[model samples]
Target: MNDGPNDTTDLFFRDATDLAHLIRTGQTTSAQVVQAHLDRIAALDPAINAIVTLNEHALDEARAADAALRRARATGGGPGPEIGPLHGVPFTVKDSIDTAGVLTQRGSPIFAGRTPQTDATAVARMKAAGAILLAKTNLPEFSYSTESDNLLSGRTNNPWNLERTPGGSSGGESAAIAAGMSPIGLGTDLAISVRGPAAQTGIVALKPTHGRVPMTGVWPRVPRRDWHVGPMARTVRDLALAYSILEGPDGSDGFATTPRGVDTGVGPAPQRRLRVGWFTDSGLGPVDPQVARTVQRAAEALRGAGVDVEEVTIPALQENNPLALFNAQHVMELKPAMAEATAGHEDEMFTMSTTMLSIPDTSMADYLAAEQGFERIRDGYAEFFSRFDALLLPVLPTFAHEHGAGELTIDGQVVDATHVQTFTVQFNITGMPALSMRFGTSTDGLPIGVQVAGPWHAESTVLHVASVLESLSPVKDQHPDL
Candidate 1:
């Protein structure tokens, strides 16, 4: 908390959309906006370790944006050049996503000095929308774990409580946004990477349907089918804005096919009488009572808002655990690539990556069986969505946990750290869209979040429901006391 004399210091806490409006209306200069966030990062990031690399030319980019805005103003209301919706706003990216000339070490020493010549599709799209890249955030090695610790960048601590993790592999991105270091950032989700971290840090994140956004330039590119690139922001509207810009095929990633009949923007009118399902546990593991209560409260809020909210159990979802399917697929597909990437530098690899490589091989028959089982899970979700607009569930079994903890206790029952993804992995397996948002605070003062999930290509529905819940959430405006 460096309380600067400049009035623009408070602007760092505003959402991306509002920041862009301030710049557009001449209320604030892009240079000032960028400087505000840069100053905040300088003051707050030391303890959090969220931002791993700062862009040296960020101020220069802000100056360029300011000049462009001045040029547009000189036109006297006549359009000269198209200004992006996010003009002059600053953003960050996960370390694994490529940024031209910026280090993308993927949280591993194996790629310690690696830098890309071209930006990832998502990065280029954000920049083209007038977002200045301020810095790169931290993640687990190759983004293999649910925590954000790594040998290259050490660990990213939760902004709410320094002793806890921010959740990963998008942990750094969420931590940065939570601490007001950046307004919004890009993160990749495979399993619970994006949504999990967002839940832990009290921010907003969207895991768009698989293929809704391009996945080009992401490292350790295994689990290709489940990998997703989405935006993490402080507001759902900002997430929608970024999603609109980042969606669609970029002609690079084969999986980035154009979505048919999908509405990327949030409409002005509120949805009416939507059907939603609420559940405390996905049956994969035990959930903290406080977390479960938060989900129930969200459902009741929606019910009060005129939405048809009901507590229903999808037996198909509860009967089988899909975590093993993901693990099997990941190990089968990524083992060869990991071996190649770290060929002679095995000692530099992190424990997670090395351990994943050591997993016993799965036969082709086993891989096929797992894929078939995954299809059944997808079908189950499709059937469930046909009856409801969205499902509300816990983002994690518990709130943020202590760093390096081998196991977590939920309701006096000890569970392995691997079960942290229990509630989130199903969506990845089903290729459905899911959004994580802050719903309430824990008894220990940590944030609790709930997941809003929808069928394939139904991101708009998911976001709409999240926006509704956000309006009724008591912790909507709450931020870490950092």
Candidate 2:
């Protein structure tokens, strides 16, 4: 590897898969890799402001990892019987997720100085896999806003332009990975938290099938059925690796339906022709022409690679409008949850939290109707997936916009900004597995990501298709200038 100025940058840029291999083979020590990231954070994080809290024991654990590798090398010719797939690699967690002994403020003064006695199930699993926790990234207050700014941790800036948002409630996690502060991370998705932020940052993120990974350690338990926790990284392969290790029942989460120890590999399966459906508009909001073209390019790329690709749309998406459906049911439900969380600390609540309180609550009748509407959407997807194996669509209707940028103007027609979640929230409602990965770039040079979603419990198919798209992507190994 080349040395000097770019050396640390090189270390941080490599995906978790490559970094773990290097560490396991003794070509590089875990300490070196971990410190390279810490050094990067020390030098560059001031401007990006993604990472909010550091793991005090990360270097110590990395050193322990290095020692374990030495012992394993002396005993056997491999990474050792004890080393897990993520052995020695460093990772970050969104603050909304718990980390034992580390501050998890949840981006609110209400949660400031709050630290858990044990890691969230996901964090513990990563630790069990030998991945060291490097830090805790920021989020919107109570993880409620589409942006990552909060009264407690301030705001996280996009690594790409500093002026644009990285997207939230997982914005800090995406921004950190994009800036090389961390290779892989853990994030939650209620609506568009993980995938949206990943799209904004030019990285890869997976929101596994609802309950595929448990929600034992994350906050916002009111909407237990809708929230999901999964992986985010610089490369699709890293996401696959993290997902394999993170999947299955934790025994504690009732929502986790997948059997324990289920790891569906991302590689090709038995011989079968896969059909992928592509779309730009979901019939809810206007999609930017560039975003539409990117989706088309991805479809054409797959077609050229010998995969069957067809332009299609789900009627339910256009009729029900998942984003609106989500708001209808969740607004009333979540407002109470937020109220409960901020009961004694009302003065500490952020604008998003207060604004949500002002919105009228849905009646039991309308809430029930919204729930039924979502079921029709689920049925619609089940029928749609019967024909296609996966979907290719835009993660965002347009490229990253300025922080708190009000109203999205698509093709000169202004629309509500929340319409950005038009494509992603559908998967959350249906409990399908979906992912975001960089495929193309905007004219102004921001990364554009395409969404790949599969039927429930079909993450392996999703990853397999994503791996192909990753190889055929028009943009690769591109990083922000931070």
Candidate 3:
């Protein structure tokens, strides 16, 4: 694994939308676009262990997109124009999400032979937007762990440090983007599956407000109150673009509601100085000294950028009980789905221990009670947001943990490798929009991210603050050495 600064210019690392623009302008053909990404995936994916299945039909679609783009140009862009907003752009989907005709094991062995006959709502949206699905990336079993390690596809290594995790369930998507295997892809965040991986990989990811993106056809066929599918990309702007395409009620998924796209444009910038809350040293047990410093530096930089940065303590929110309850309820929702995904493969390596199931099962009644408690917590945040426009906090307690290692321990505390997702789950519970923007690196050189969260349905404010941080810190162009 080549670890220092990455300079894979021979590889295609530009934003997917930019590549689509090139195709639309005739600067590049879709066939060429597809080959470029496929070649890169073939060459670099081996190192990160991020890709599990490649779309064999990718080139055929690419050729069609090329023909369509040329025909559009010849007719002055007539007859339906290009098929999708991302027409011909190569992309990936987390293995947990279904792509028609593709294998979607959900990182478990029991469903090793499983295949879907229909595209997931998010995948269908991308296809309708003109995206050419390239491959399906790896993830933890049923996306239950914060670290990606499954019996079928092994583990996804962090690009920054191959020995460290990319961040779970969505690690493959995050690693693939970090290594430029694919420019942009979809990730589902129930806990921090999206944000955690993005934070560890130095990429931009968002878990849109609940019901913003349709979750139909997502495997495990479960309805998660804390999960939403969103975009993962190297640039925040690219994430915004993809989010615009994927947002809206698909009419099929009962959980999805809003169909509003990015027409709201970029929300108003903070007119008066914005009051930002920062939590560096939350007494959340042996907080990584490096993570604390990284977050502090980021907060200080935002303050320097003319924002009112307050060192406020969200103690009640910071405590894990409410978050734990929320996660337990989510686990309850997944039990049946888990049974389906793991059927007949219970004896597979890395299979869940009886103890793992017992925790959520035992907490069943408490899980329901926790659901009620979570509402109160969400209300508390609502009240807090009434005073402040956004809240800033660490995306993870520490930098990327060592890749391929089983179980994650921090500060002598054993956290469910999956449950450490506490940092990102709260915003999901409140149905608020949160952006995991790259801030800086840890002392050990792993990426550390800060969450920019806003009130429910206030995606504009969340993104506005994210854009400001993007401009202030300016970590967008940096890529990993594959």
TM for every model, in the order presented, reads 0.96, 0.97, 0.90
Over the stretch 264-323, how does candidate 1's per-residue lDDT look in tens digits?
433335455688998996566799999999999999999999889999887766666788
Per-candidate count of clashing residue pairs (backbone under 3 Å): 0, 0, 11
Model 3, span 1-482: residue lDDT tens: 11221233433777887777767666667787788788888788888889999999999999988888777767875435445679889899999898899998888776788899999989998899889999999988877777888878888888888888898769999999998888999998876879989999999898888888888877555646667898999887788888888888888877777657532323656448787887854544445666777678878888988888888766556544555676567666776666665566567736443335555463657776877778777777867877787888888877788754455677677765554566777777777788887888776777878888877777777777787788877465777766
Once superposed on the true structure, which residue ranges of model 3 sit more than 4 Å away at CA?
A: 1-11, 77-83, 221-223, 261-266, 281-283, 318-320, 340-344, 353-355, 363-365, 404-419
Pairs clashing within candidate 1: none
> Per-residue CA lDDT of candidate 2, range 4-120, in tens?
224555697888888888788777888999999999999989999999999989999999999998888788876656998889999999999999999988899888899999899
lDDT of 3: 0.78
Model 1: ten consecutive residues of lowest lDDT: 263-272
Rank candidates, lDDT, best first.
2, 1, 3
